[model samples]
Target: MSPYLLIQLAALGLYLFLVAVNWSALPEPMAVHFDASGDPNGFMSQAWGAVGIPLMVWAMFFGLTVLGRDPGFFARMKRFSPSGWRAWAEFNTLMGLGLLTVSSMTVLYNVEAIPGEWIGYSVWIFLAFAFLAIYRLASVGR
Candidate 1:
């Protein structure tokens, strides 16, 4: 198995574990959205936060893994696909980790395990990673 896939598997396992153990501790209406200052501005049921978000994350992992395996899938998009598998792996790893980070942070913040400032920071950090992924994709083949 690819190292990226293994890392993704580990991340997914950890995420599931976190949600399962914290299931009861999480508030009924968890804070699922935050404002510019990291204050909770929107809420959703714990069920949605715990289940719906993970579903989306897993969907991303599934899509990335499938596409990575068939490098040709990306090759079809000649304009952006990088020439090497490393670029693809990095893209997948960064994206999967980014999703897990935000979702896990949401859980931790709602349980008062982490401060609100970290919430805003995490989003910015991941946004940087998203841009880095694009840069790697664009630069690798050149």
Candidate 2:
């Protein structure tokens, strides 16, 4: 399996685990309220987790597995093409940036809806910076 895919699977599993943990902590009334409202707060919290933790893990693995390795390391290790990786990078970068912008605006507009709006803002800003750093690195190479 591709490292990226593995990272995603691990992320999803972790996300589910987090939800399970958090869900268990809530009272029945709040849980029902969350379900009724589609749990926007929970959704945002999970999203932040899914994006933040797993991406860091994947970056570490990518650095170790791909960087300073053999020239055809990716080609031999995975079936994904360079073009496909490029597309994936672009898509994720845009999504990361979008999430950052949206989360910031959400914090600014509805600070009472969710806890830790300041943390969310900071996390989103980090994600935005990470994406921009990756984009800049990619562009310099190209």
Q: Give me the candidate number with maximum lDDT.
A: 1
Total residue pair clashes for candidate 1:
0
lDDT tens digits, residue span 69-128, model 1 = 685676766654435566777787888888888889999998899988898999999999
The per-prediction CA RMSD against the true structure, in angstroms, equals 2.1, 10.2
Q: What stretches of model 2 exceed 4 Å from their correct place? A: 27-87, 90-115, 133-141
Instruction: State the TM-score for model 2.
Output: 0.38
lDDT (0-100) at residue 97 of candidate 1? 87
Indicate the TM-score of model 1.
Answer: 0.88
The C-alpha lDDT values of all candidates are 0.83, 0.44
- In candidate 1, list every pair of residues with a backbone clash: none
Cα lDDT tens digits, model 2, 45-130, are 43344345445544554444334234464556354456545545444444444443443333332333344444445555667776
* Clashes by residue pair, model 2: none
